[model samples]
Target: MKDNASLLRRKDAATPRGVGVMAPFFVSRAENAELWDVEGRRFIDFAGGIAVLNTGHRHPKVVAAVKAQLDAFTHSAYQVVPYEGYVALAERLNRLTPGAFPKKTTFFSTGAEAIENAVKIARAATGRSGVIAFSGAFHGRTMMGMALTGKVVPYKTGFGPFPPEVYHVPFPTALHGVSVEDTLKALQLLFKADIEPKRVAAILIEPVQGEGGFYVAPPELMRALRRLCDEHGILLIADEIQTGFARTGKWFAMDHHEVAPDLMTTAKSLAGGFPLSAVTGRAEVMDAPAPGGLGGTYAGNPMSIAAAHAVLDVIEEEGLVQRANQLGERMRGRLEALKTRVPQMAEVRGLGAMLAVEFCAPGGHTPDPDFTRAVQARALERGLMLLTCGVYANVLRFLFPLTIPEPVFAEGLSLLESALTG
Candidate 1:
């Protein structure tokens, strides 16, 4: 009834201006890592809906789950009338997340909701009010999440007086010349100058920072945080919203570290393509929320839970974790080789399929956000979709679907390289 541009204009007037849309290409449908816009144009989706399509769009198992669920039931929220799929999904998450101790999981509708509830549980359990967040972490878009996030341009700009008692400390980045010990010192200083150790409720961080950058947190840093939490009685939270599922070549990114966290937040690929988020953690910490204290009207919709169950099945049945490793390795290797041709490409780093190529001015570390934007635009024009992030906005992240055909992945990478070089 209406053209894409006209429809988008109507939507813009109705919806708030707070949302930042990527190209105006309204996707009609997608399968695996490929998307077809309403105009009937095909584009290789390197963005993957900002890493939410790890299983790829409309994966067969995930699609089947949704279809089957549509025939049975869609709602009757878990809080109102609990269902089997919800409990089963929670049990699976508990077993899957990294931790030896008993764990419990609760679901939500989004990553921000999961993160918010996790903080509430930690605060209630520890009887503390302060939370320590890292400088480059992207928690979510909620008020509390915005407070926890480390960026300022779009995510945190004009968003002030965020949730209280949230303090920030530097996050070590090798490319930025910050060390793990330096981060530790900043935390120590924060405790002494701003928030006291006794008042701290949690220290939440992204295992692999998303939105901010595709920076993988080092194992040493993870282990150090675990130790610090142990000594300070503060709960350590691993926000694996982006790195969860099979994106990081592991079921959970924390699996890369020797230590475990008191709480973990997951979303994005949890329910295949459905919207679902969860907080799984130590049994005791989870129990902090009283029976009536936690839960919402649409907290764990049966349809979404069913889809999550199917997502897990697909991940295992397809061996997507291993697939992620293979795919990520291939992508990174190609980008590394291209570095010689594109002198502006400063570093290529990431874990598994959550890889990124950071760019800078040629021969210098001066971030080249303009070049990054140009490359992304060029890629889009050439029928490849890409996304950018980082505090300086100079990193191009690749989140191709694990189900993407090898040839298709190669084709997208080649186009991307040409864009960078051109």
Candidate 2:
């Protein structure tokens, strides 16, 4: 309706241009795997708010909990006044996240804050200043987070002179011709050329590279990092912001590996649709930050805690982890078959529901971002939403809500097939 168009126009006028938004479709409502625009035209939510709605939009349990919390009270920063929901959420994270060591969790308002605090704690605990990030990683928009992020365009452009002692190394990706050995070599080089390992506070990595592409960190690679960290006293930090909850068929994407990181960062899906990020880690490391060192005005705000507690409960009771696996297998199989039809289709890979279909030229050697753009345009016209990624911008990541029905998923796949052929 004209109302949707008008709202979008108003949004453009009011919001900062730095925030890049696509297709100004105003959402009237979103439920499960679909979103209805203000005009009531329904579109499948394959983007799922960029993997934030792992349990799907407004899941009954999550909604009920938020409403219940509203009836009582909203804000009371945990520091000022303790809340049961905050403690409950932390307890859940401590129990669910990987690692047998005693763990503690602290909440924040966004993934970036969680990451920043995680790094702070790591440095405070180890008394070091160096951190190693990876190529193609997207940490966040904040200065320190951007310094840690590898992507240079939109994210890091014009905002140079980032935090000191931050270095970038290669991340393993077979399709991109990057190997685990290459990654390890880059890390070794980083130590020798950039900073000594003993002086490095932490090495932060996404279990599955999120904004870069859905490149899963190899189990061998993670184990090697664990070994290296143990040898050098560097804390291993796993950023599960986009792959936590049921998105990866596990509580945390790091759970896929046998090795456990010293610290894990999570957000996005943590508080259902609300904002809540956290840093969960070994008790000793987490306690590195002195009593008042790790928090914000909104950190562990009462309302976010209520939502997070409900999210954990919903994930546990619904068997969403298994559901994510089934969804991944089904979607990835279809994508694999499409490789034959589209010789440009490079690779189909992922773990659980977090999957991606990358495209390259006919030789399957060079990324085809142009073709990827065309595919996305066609799909959007057909009422199917999609998001792209990759350092080369040639990846089409599919993050359909794990709770989507079988028929809806199949229908989206059919439409996607049509888009590719067109």
Candidate 3:
């Protein structure tokens, strides 16, 4: 087996510097909430593949489902030959996602594709071209996705000349100075100066900002958006890519709010590590994009479709939604206790198991990305893997699998305590 040092040399030589890697070692094997490096070092997986393994790595049911699909045949191209798994999954999502109105669901290969197509559908349905996104929101990396994303560095640095009529307003967060009224004022200003409300197609937002920070959207803000959309005939598109599938203690984070979005984009943990995303919405809006306007060569592969079905089954059978709530309370309590000792810890926020801790300079709210890096490094040395995010890069987000064993979870928390204190 190749040692991590030797593999690093090869990786640096063969890959571009733009593709950043967090861990120094390469993975050889992984199970639920754990991984083994090529050199035989074991790690407690807290990253969860960036919120793509909420069901955990290689879940036996998911693996068995994929194996069964492989035995049957892999790809038939749902649009070409079509398969039952694809249709069945769509039916399930339509029934599962928020909104009691008649809904329709379509599959895609990635979150960006789903977001892009949702925009197309919204534009087609409303006969408008403008879209409104929020500050510190992460949609995706594709052209349209980046256009919708609120971050500047790394993501939108040199990718200028993005799609026009995409505007951004502040999202309410106490960590930042932005408030719900401020958010509304910005939107009103956009309508008065940049784009007219009538020309707006959709207003997209994450129920919980992912890469920006694990900031949950206030219920008041959600209701305001719904009201604005209703008043203007604009569709409210909930980008639940990272917050879906019980990550926020519910199937979809929007479920926490009483308002129902016209469209919802979902991916990441949808297929239990397999690449599959979806756009589920009111039937009329979904049908706006004519047949040929949607679909991809590998949209809804049978293997991924099979895995998704099993993932849904596991979520219900394991009672993961409730598990998420329990895990969130425990983690938040532990982290809150650490804050008494770790002066740099600014805030602990999120819903359910989707939580994050932000760091700042001691006795001040100034972001401390350096200290965040130190904490992550210390955690890695102790055999724990953690991920850092937020626009300021001073927040450490937790995305461990809901299925993590009790002892393993406790051990990870102990390691985290050491990381924060040491």
lDDT of each: 0.89, 0.89, 0.94
Candidate 3 weakest ten by summed lDDT: 171-180
Identify the leading candidate in terms of TM-score. 3
Write model 2 residue lDDT over 1-422, tens digit each, in one string. 35777897898889998899866688888888888888888888789898888878999888898889999998877788888888878988999999998999999999999899989999999999999999999888999999999888779889889889998889998886899999999898887887988899999999999889889999999999999999999999999999999898887898899999999999999988899999999999899888899888899877778888888887888888999999899888888888778988888888998999888899857889999999999998898999999988999998887778788888898888888888
Clashes of 2: 0
Model 1 clash pairs are 212-390
lDDT (tens digit, per residue) of candidate 3 on 1-422:
58999999999999998788999999999999999999999999999999999999999999999999999999988788998889999999999999989999999999999999999999999999999998888888888989999988778888888988899999888876778899999999999999999999999999999999898999999999999999989999999999999999998899999999999999999999999999999999999988789999999989999999999999999999999999999999999998889999999999999999999998888999999999999999999999999898999999999999999999999999999999
Per-residue accuracy of model 1 over 149-258 as CA lDDT, tens digit each? 99988888987989899999888788889898899999989988898898999999998888777888889999889988999899999999999989989888999988
In candidate 3 the C-alpha lDDT for residue 376 amounts to 100
Candidate 1, which ten residues in sequence have the lowest lDDT sum? 1-10
Model 1 lDDT, full chain set: 0.89
